[model samples]
Target chain A: MPFWLDAVRRFERAIGVPVERFVTSDAYFDLLPHLKRAQSQLEDAVAAMTEEWYRLVNLPSGSDVRQMREQLSRMERQIERLTKQLADRDATGPTPTVRKRDQNG
Target chain B: MWPLLGSDLAGRVGRDLERSLWRARNGLRYVQAMSRPREGATPKDVVWKRDRAELWRYRSETPIRYAPPVVIVHSLVSRSYILDLRPGSSHVEYLLAQGFDVFMLDWGIPDERDADNSFETYVDEYMPLAVDAALAVSGAHEVTLSGYCLGGVFGILYAASYSEPPVRNLVLLATPIDFSQMGPMVAAVASGRLDTAELLDETGNVPPDALYTGFYMQAPTKEIAQYATLLENLWNDEFVDAYQAMAQWSRDHVPLPGAATRQIVDDLIRRNVLASGRWELGGREIDFGDVQANVLNAVAVKDNVVPLAVTEPVMQLVGEPSKRDELRLTGGHVTFGAGSHAFKHTLPALSRWLADHSDELDSPKER
Candidate 1:
């Protein structure tokens, strides 16, 4: 119903799917590298990775696999962020609004 | 007036004028394809074997290993020799001189049985098989896959999907990626206003006249109206050669498999699949990331079948930096390939890009 949703919906309609409402899938770890880039929210990256992968493969409409992949990515990103925040609190009582990934890996 | 516009009077006058122009283009093509080689008109020989998939090879006389061999895969709608027309204007000759091996996959005209053949047959079966044969002959682990127009689209799709394709670089010339922007030719085929199945039922392969009429209808100004004017300008010999060659080539067309046409319209034009990055071929997924090789997305600034807006989307789809690059310049779709600008610029761009990025290429056979 929103304009952004409508734009994405138009794209999905052209793509012949319900990507807008579909939940993410379990193949989330495949996007680990991409998720590292988006510090704040995993939903956006998960959504992108799912929709694009589907188009590339030319899968038919309503692919449960693609949805599962997105759902996993979002959850992984969220958990990864929570772990980082908790570690950051232990290192210092209060943190600055700006956050960064620990790049030891 | 209908006859004046559609009558034999108009056709006769139009044909005569076009005959001259096709002659000039063909002459230029002959000179381009053959005149060099230092040996005169003797064509570089191939073993010439006929397989389920029709293919021909033109090894350069003075062979050089600049890149892996170049495999030319053209549209299902035409003959392969269009690229190797004569000597001067041949695309194969030019690539051979540039120090690359060349092979062409010719989808020979189909008959009644071919009507059942689908796009999957070509992408899943014909093209991949051709690549295997070329790799076996060239002994090169990777290649520069160059495809023209619709052939380019198929080439891009194939290169993207196949795992570790024996391709060093992917070249897409005047290939359409976003069919939504295509002119009336595709739109008619897409909207179901033109029933592909019914037409295929009536005729095994879609007729050449039907294809030409659709293409010409898009630019009647160039196809008919311009010829009406060119009758006065026919004195030039160059004009005569190019006109005759092009006219002959235009009328001579290969039929598209009915099933193949159906898939293309449904998946590409109607559904707008490829650009969306969800296109599936041969069971495996086809993400741009899968094609880690260098890509040269060369688009003609003025093409009708594959407009710049459409053909250019491949650049956006691929990975960054050394992975992909684009050349957005002048020339109509097919003309950019054979004419003067091609030699002056496009060939060099292809050569330089391949040479510079040759290191990033994976030669699976090398190990």
Candidate 2:
């Protein structure tokens, strides 16, 4: 093993002491909420601007893509369920015979 | 003695010169060859599929030794290809050779769309669905569920939540239980230098670059030192090959969904939820003591990310002492799954343990 690996390990251990002391202090957790709020506002502004640009171009937006993705995902699940049902039926063989009705109507 | 020394020194110089010339000639070709490192070299079929997740069953030529199929749940933070890295260095290949039908549930790369996906999405939704699919594909009623790192956290939560888990055996590789025992990254997060929720809000999903930043903070000098070692051993083909492969694997970090990031920050890192055993999902209480499956808590002793303290507590929480086993080996986090030591020592022992606990070997026809 290289001598530096031991040095790195020792350095890590040395740094942990101060980090632990700093983190567990009450002041650290207190600052979190404020940071979260500011970031949220900035994100919203960026999203709104991006959405507007995409809208002006007459192209689908992120929201539109997300909606389509969800729709396709649901369809995929439905297909999977129907495929499984068909496989199960094939495995056991069909039990009930199909009856023709309402053709006259 | 002087003449002998002189002749020996001359011979050594000649050999070094020859080796240097050889390296100079082939160095670029070697670099090019290493650049095209093939990952997930094992052949597998997609047995089950869900949104951004798939269960793959690897092809096996030999008869499966164990009846209970093994399902590996990979850490969401990175790609699952680490377990199936390459031909000689694959955990999946080793398990398959041991006559165990193996399935890997890979959570493919998450993007902004998956921002809404939370711990609930994985523990309550995708995992159960994947388990059912694994059972269906393998024709086995029960499975040996193995998880690596964050994936193990999900596995443990799932195992504890279900009244009677469909899993016969549970394996946790470098899984953290006590978040309080987390390393400097957790310390830095707790220090309030940055608000995790706000960071997640800015980017709907936590970017890989941010995750890399956190990892780098833990050992700032490690990456630089690794590069130094790589350059020093550039003339050695074997060293270069291994280093290149590992370097590529390390670089392939995945984004974490925002909601998932929030939960990890609040529930896991800050609150130390897993240690509390009061964790709830979908109004259901998840107590670690509720898990009854034969458990193997395999921890890498030298693992900096999920250190010994972070993982050791879970062994005490499990209900059955006889069922709970620990395999403490000396390696870093990812090395347990990919390193040469794992192939020779840990993997074989792990395979035997699974085989011994499983009743699947008794009835091949049933499978």
Candidate 3:
């Protein structure tokens, strides 16, 4: 093995133990929520800015496309469900209508 | 003494320089190889698809195994191509060659619309349907369900919920049942360090990067170690190809549905529902003791993502001790699917187990 390679492996092995312990430790995990919150806020800001840019340029934004696609998908699912229901009803035959017995009685 | 030390130092420097040059040359080749497309090499047909998820049957010229079909349940976080990575290094190919009918449940990328897709939907609705599809296409009455990572969690839940499950044998590959042992990922959620609710609500979905980054944080030195190993083995063609293929798969992550993420937070991470057997779905309590399928729980000894402690509890949970089996493999998280040792030991062991328990084959008249 190369001298540098040996050194690198040694360094990795040395740090691997402590790093694994620390990374999974309670102290580390406890701080993640705040970091995640900040990250979410940052992402929101960037998304808003991108949308604004799209509006200014008179081009369709990502959110707009997503919304439209979602609408289309929803319609497709509704149609599929309806089609299945129609098939089932046909297979099962029509339900009988209730008799007008109250007036006769 | 000074002259001897000087000569020794010179010789060491000379050897280092030569090795560095060789590594640099190979490293360049590694880079070039990486640019090529490197996943899903096996030909497959989408036998069935529902919404974003699809059940794929790999095409094979070899005769099918007499055992019931095997369907791989991929994790929600990653794509399914990792199993069918390349021709030589594919788990799907090996299973196919071993005569097992291989199918994969690929949960394609989820969008904002899938935000409401919850655990109940996956375990109760989609999973059972997928199993039915696999059984239908293969002409098998039951399927040997093989769950990888989070997929195993879903598999366990499904098996527990259904009294007469379509699954004949349950194989869990590095699946985490005890969330408390999931290290930093669970710790973050358990301690309120990572507010899964706020993140899901704000974003409507957990993007691929967010999920990937969470795993990355668990082992910060993993990438460095991986690259260093790559550099060392850059000269080997086989190593380079495998590395490139795996690296490509690693980058291709899928966004997890928001509702599912919420369930993960509340049920698994925070409350430890699966471990406690208190998780109920579709009016059925998910008790592993109810699962009657022959269970093969394989846990990786060196798995950093899902630690050994995280996976070991499932043996006790199963109803029958005689039917329960465990294998401690010698690789980390991704190795069960991609490692050479897996192809040698893990896949073959699983195949034997399936064949051994095959009801159709065991029955003389049916055979």
Instruction: Give the local distance difference test score of model 3.
Output: 0.77
TM-score winner among the candidates? 3
Chain B TM-score of candidate 2 stands at: 0.90
Give the Cα lDDT of each candidate: 0.61, 0.75, 0.77
- Which residue runs of candidate 3 sit more than 4 Å off their true CA positions? A13-22, A39-105, B1-38, B201-203, B359-367
Model 3, A17-60: lDDT tens digits are: 79878877876666666676778789878878999999999999
- Across residues A4-47, which tens digit of lDDT does each residue of candidate 1 receive? 54555455455433321121112322342244335324655675
The digit string of per-residue lDDT tens for model 2 on B1-367 reads 9999999999999988876776675567556765574558799998777668888999867677687899999898987888887777788988888788899989888865567678888887688878888877777778888999998888888777766678788999999889888865576565555677546523377888877755654545556556656555666877766666677777677889888888888788877888876576666666788787899999888888899999998788854778899988877797656778888777887887888888656644322
DockQ scores of all models, one per candidate? 0.01, 0.06, 0.19
lDDT of 2: 0.75
- Report the Cα lDDT for candidate 1: 0.61
Q: How should the candidates be ordered by lDDT, best one leading?
A: 3, 2, 1
DockQ order of candidates, best first?
A: 3, 2, 1
Q: List candidate 2 segments past 4 Å from native.
A: A1-105, B1-14, B21-38, B201-203, B360-367
Candidate 2 chain B worst ten-residue window by lDDT: B358-367
Candidate 3 residue-wise lDDT, B1-367, digit = tens? 9999999999989977876786777778767866665548789899877678888898888777466888899899887888888787788888788677889998888876567788877786578778877776677778888999999888887777765777788989988888988875677677676777665533377888877777677667767667777778765667877887888777777888888888888888888887875577666566677777889998889898889999998888854688999988888888766878778877777777777876434432211
Span of ten consecutive residues with least summed lDDT in model 3 chain B: B358-367
